[model samples]
Target chain A: METKKIKLPLTKEDVLGLNVGDMVLITGQLVTGRDRVHKFLFNERPRKEEIPFNLDGAIIYHCGPIIRKSDEGWRLIASGPTTSMRVEMYEHWVIGEYGIRGIMGKGGMGKHTLGALKKNGCAYLHTISGAAVYLAERVRKVIDGWKIDDFGIAEAMWLFNVEDFPAIVTMDAHGKSLHDDIEKTSYRELLRLIGL
Target chain B: MLKLRDGIIELYRKVATSLPPDVEDALKSAYIIEENGSNAKQALSTVLENILLARETSRPICQDTGVPVFYVKVPIGLSQVELKDTIIESTRIATEKIPLRGNAVDIITDKNTGDNTGKGFPVIYFEETHDSTLTIDLMLKGSGCENTGQIYKLPVEELGAERNLEGVRRCVLDAIHKAQGRGCPPYTLGVGIGASKDQVTRLAKDQLIRKLTDTNGAPVLADLEKRLLNEINQLGIGPLGFGGKTTAIGVKVGVNHRHPASYFVDISVCCWANRRGRLIW
Candidate 1:
């Protein structure tokens, strides 16, 4: 149970240092994106003015958070990770184009995303799925957002100042994946159980 | 006395904010038995803690509060139309007040309604019961787990699965196998077996409303449920599929009379959250 305290915007060295099953408590800025943002980032390849936040060395959280507007500002009600595989198709391109350094999500990505993570110096951090309220407490503030109107609240990219946000590096820059290992073992067990 | 709309809103809030007692109990037992410092143990610990925090803060347990599904039972002559209208209205109120995620999207336009309501949204099923009391069961099923659900027409040669219970068992194991770590297990599976695809799909989802502690009346189904539960947990696809002892905490099977020509099975894969509640008025 080696836990690393990580501060973003990460360097390539920071990503290379993590390994599968190593838990990390990350601080500093995290920008949330999901299906819509991935497609836009990959397809449009927007220049500086379109995207409000910096993607260079930035950690992207694969989330469609439940956010509400408050008198002071916006309140993140529940900030759980969405399934990571859905955005796997666009993630590789997003990572390469935007210089993304870290991916925080649940249910780790597929082979392409893993390969991109290895080639591009990134790590896939797996948070506890559906542990929304608990994880939301770690978000220090709602820094800013873009595409809230066009993409909708859930799909929009919002910058968050999070402190000690907990996650485990399931898919590391070394091309190791805990998900693949678990799936293979479980598939073997399934075959054994079904007598196939 | 609370109005029906108030009751429905409260039901939505309850399910969104907290899981039922049986689910929490199952999670607790699974947590107790897992190896300390294991990834599976740590994940379950976070889940348990999250559930408590949501309860304390009255916040949604998961951001994907899911597509709201309602199972409504009304007395004879009670207007289902009126009840559905109230349900739709209550859904809007719950979306804003409870602050549930606006999940319903326009299939054609690719736009979120931003209120969790749209054409055929907040799926509702109505049954006219013989009794006077009206009851509604609400489930906030997360999309991640729902996508893991599998529907199969039996007698498939690939797995050597036939139409009988033995075949059903094979199909179930395959479904769980394919699901792997994607849906955030330890899962509570609801299996529906019937003659038609639509019928079985509904039956499967209906079975999910059954409590983790409920006992199936049919001895054969109960035995199959017990065996399937044991077998799935044996797959070592523990909490978040990090690998440990518990892949699934409960397996529920609801069988219906099938036609001579067709045998269909649907598996409703529910994540550990398994958020659900009932309102009677």
Candidate 2:
């Protein structure tokens, strides 16, 4: 019922109020995953206690980064966002199932996802597609990898502790969707401008 | 005559490593010039930065180092290379250096290999032309755009040329609408007319490598492209389908003469991040 605006470097007291199109800089822990990782979680059904990363109030990125073995550790060559729509079939279930508060990926969410976001107090964040290298810079650490060798880089489930991960709020919990609202208003404006 | 094996290998290497000039320029220009008030524009800016970072850091553009799609135009009289093997070997090398994600999965066996190189990894299409040099167009197609691809059949009896054209326009709009916030808008449309179901589908996929700025000289098709572009934009799908006037940067139609018994049309759409490249040898 009450909403608040938050700034970057979000602290415990600060709340993030993201509109659908607002560019945001996130600082904190974020997780990385893809279809394989999702299926693996669904099949394994890891206990809440046994889950590799904490899901509460954490942002999960639907991405598969190109990682190569290096002297320091695995090096991220490109880790861009994948289209989130394909994972939509599983996302709502995952958000409800895992208590995830935020999701980061390119492309907007569908109606079902919007509903899930509303019911679950979650938000859908979008980033630039094909901008892996630029995005990788925000990542400060690779915390731990669950089944790293099994799924490989693109398909692997790797947890990342990141800082200032840039994103836009595309869907919100209050049924306020920046994408839907923008499309509606913009179309009306275009129609008026063109006398259509 | 360039040695067949060597030439093909070289061509494959070039195609795999570098992005096509037109495609690269268009993407860069889109980021700079195209402005829709959505994450799409910001994302485009980030994508440009990412591209630069990827090149500078020697990383694959994206982690899902996509399945390779090759379109080769060979000269009939050019005595140069083993085209097929060239594709295989070049793909193999590119998979190693380009470090592409191993996407080929054995459908029946259900096996997973991490490297993006395997049997039928670089899907190659070859055409023999009356010329000297060979032109190889390669596209690193990720699964996101690939999955959004669709094929709709319109029977000739029910939908004649007028209707089929209308049908094509409808299909494009439907795809954009249904794919809202998916397929990453400010995208490109590939339309295939004529040919069998598989043929039409393949034709549309091949056009993914054609740059948005390039236009074939058929007046009818060009007009179709223009009309489809306008209609789809009117849907206000915008960039990334976030709602804007620029849903598609361009629409490309690849037409083939089909049999009279029945006619078919298919449409394939690619996101703004069209990851394709070109090479000649």
Candidate 3:
């Protein structure tokens, strides 16, 4: 497992070098969003100028974190990646419209998103799905939030500064997907089991 | 009654943070079987480490704390309605105190209730029992694993499935194979054979509350459970579907008689977290 350290606002060259199964530790600013946030960006079609943060070369995390308000504004009590498949329908459009460089999530996405990664110069990073506290410790600070009232806390888009956040490149900019490979091999194994 | 409420709240905290003894033991054993430096081993190591960290920090073991489902056995004199209310209230308290993720959402509205309670949330099933004391079993069913659950009708020639044990075996294995890494392996599967669609599904979910080490009372079912567990691990789906040994840690099967025309099999796959707890009072 080759380990790579990537900074925010990644370039095409930065993501293109990554391959399926390579490990990565990302640093700098990352944005959080899940199903509703993706819908808001892709279907609602908000103007880039109206958006609170710059989308160019950004890393959008697929997560609906367990958070609470504290003296420090907001505290991420338990934060882990949600299943990425839920956002698959909107990912292609979002990647193109937002100039996204990477997506961090669990349960690697499907073919459409894999094609979008190749087309848009992006990669899909898979994090440990249930390791909430371990992932939360990597979050240094909550920078800002948007659409809390309409979308609720879980669905709201919150920005954060992270250091050494670990993930694996399951879908790379070269049109490769580890998830798809696993499904195919597993299905073959299943067929053999039933003597098909 | 007050003690029971407090006990339920404490139970929620314990279930959210710690893997039960039986589940932890199964996972540890599964980790031992995986080859060193394999992706499956790496995934299992992270899962074990996360369990320890969650206990130490008093945080939820998974970000998706899951919907709380409770099964209660009570004496005839106990008020089922009041007990249901207590469970609801305790769930609300647990949402803030143990800080469970707000999981209940209205399907039509796409609105999260913020608290874990809503119209049909914190599902509680009551059973009348001869015993005087009340017993409660709780399972935190995560969305990831729940999504992989499925029901299949038997006598389908396509899969060569009949209404017999062989058919049951096929459906169960198919479900596990399809789940792969999506449901978070190594998993514990709850299999319900021979009931109506709704009842069979409930029977499958209810089986999940049993301890991993417990065996089915029926001899035939016990044998089937053992066979399924062995065959599932052989699938090589391993932990997080990276492919290795130890796809499933355990399999529990619960059977009920069904209509002559139907042979339904319902399967509920639980991730390695296997968050469950019991309270007796």
Candidate 4:
């Protein structure tokens, strides 16, 4: 129930102090990425010169926003978190390779991701899954984007300036996961109901 | 016909932004039953607040606006081609006007059409009927729930599932168990039993268009729906799978005759948002 406001480029101490079920309101520079971005970063391994931004201690968001081109520039209409488990295959590689400190998305990741988070001193944040309009209000600005043509709107990487971007620490750096625990208890309950 | 096109856009807007009344009611009741100060309650409150914001702001209720699926019932003498073209045009217009997330992508080229319309986009299921009036039902189904949908060919030896209702019960519960938090519970399950493998899945999805508040016409199916709903909620997979009393708000089951050799059970899961609307022309 603790509400902590954390800045990006998080340190080991910053993530280690958080525990599963703790609520956080993150502020600072964040980059949005999803299925394609994960593949691009880990699988494709773009040339160093093609890398658009530095990833050292960066926070990666699992989001593919609904953005429109306005008279001035890109306008974010609804940007909610996408399911994170889709990127579980490449999360470990991306976290270790990029020196990422935090991952924000919905539904928790799998065992590999949890292990990677523990090893890399990173934490996984869970946002309300379909709160598109509510989450969009927290975005202060859209800084820039990269690989737009290559990945499409849902998969492109967009840098955003978000303030008080709320999420819950569902998987902490200590190797604990709220999702895994819930699944275990719920499964037991299911079996009990079915008399299995 | 132009009016129908405009009505389709409005329907899309309504489906994208406003949570349906039946769904909102279910959510409200679930919130009331959730323990005070529990994580499940907190999650449900967040979802309720999000729905309010979406309605006020006229923005998508979820980031993945999902593929626009239309179920159309046409009267005799109506041109199916004309109706489909109107739907496609309206979908593109809605993608820009309601500004729905450009969800339809070209799988081969890895490109987004950007307007939510592409080859075979805005999936339409047509039914020609004797009634003179035309009715269209639309549902915006997000991928999170879509991914959790399952189809199993019975008898599933592992689960001891057969072709009877007992087997269908086992499969439905298994699907709910597998979904856990991923499908964004509480879910509205649409179960289709006894159709061919390919058609069974479509039958399951078609069941999702039924109003959440409507009761099944068949007595046996209605009883099964009641039992499934009660058992699923008892799993404590509450709001967002955090653990509580309400995991699923509704379960709609549709059954059809099957071939002698094969029995298929298909489940279509829809998250709490349950964005759906209807139009009559």
Error of 2 at A174 (Å): 1.0
On DockQ, the stronger of 1 and 3 is 1
Quality of candidate 4 docking, DockQ: 0.74
Question: Which docking band does candidate 1 fall into?
Answer: high
Best by DockQ: 1
For model 1, residues B41-146, the per-residue Cα lDDT tens digits are 9999999999999999999999999988899999998898899989999999999999999999998888999998999898999999998999899988889999
Model 1 quality (TM-score):
0.98
lDDT of 2 by residue, B1-281 (tens): 23644554454444433455665676666556556454456666666676667667666666666777778888886433566765676555556665666677766664556545567766777789876767877776666766777766664332232336665665555555556656766777787878589888888876676667777789878888887777776776666655555677778988888877646677777766566665666
Residue B220, candidate 4: alpha-carbon lDDT: 94
Global CA lDDT computed for model 2: 0.67
Which prediction has the highest TM-score against the true structure? 1
Error of 1 at B116 (Å): 1.0
Correct interface contacts retained, every candidate: 0.88, 0.63, 0.50, 0.67
DockQ in order: 0.87, 0.44, 0.65, 0.74
Model 1 scores a C-alpha lDDT of 0.92
Better of 1 and 4 by lDDT: 1
lDDT string for model 4 (B21-61, tens) is 98999999999989988778888898899999999988888
Which of the two candidates, 2 or 3, achieves a greater lDDT against the reference?
Answer: 3
User: What ordering of candidates by DockQ runs from best to worst?
Assistant: 1, 4, 3, 2
**Residue by residue across A97-175, what tens digits does model 2's lDDT show?**
8877788887766788888887877788777776666777877777677777666666777777676777777787768
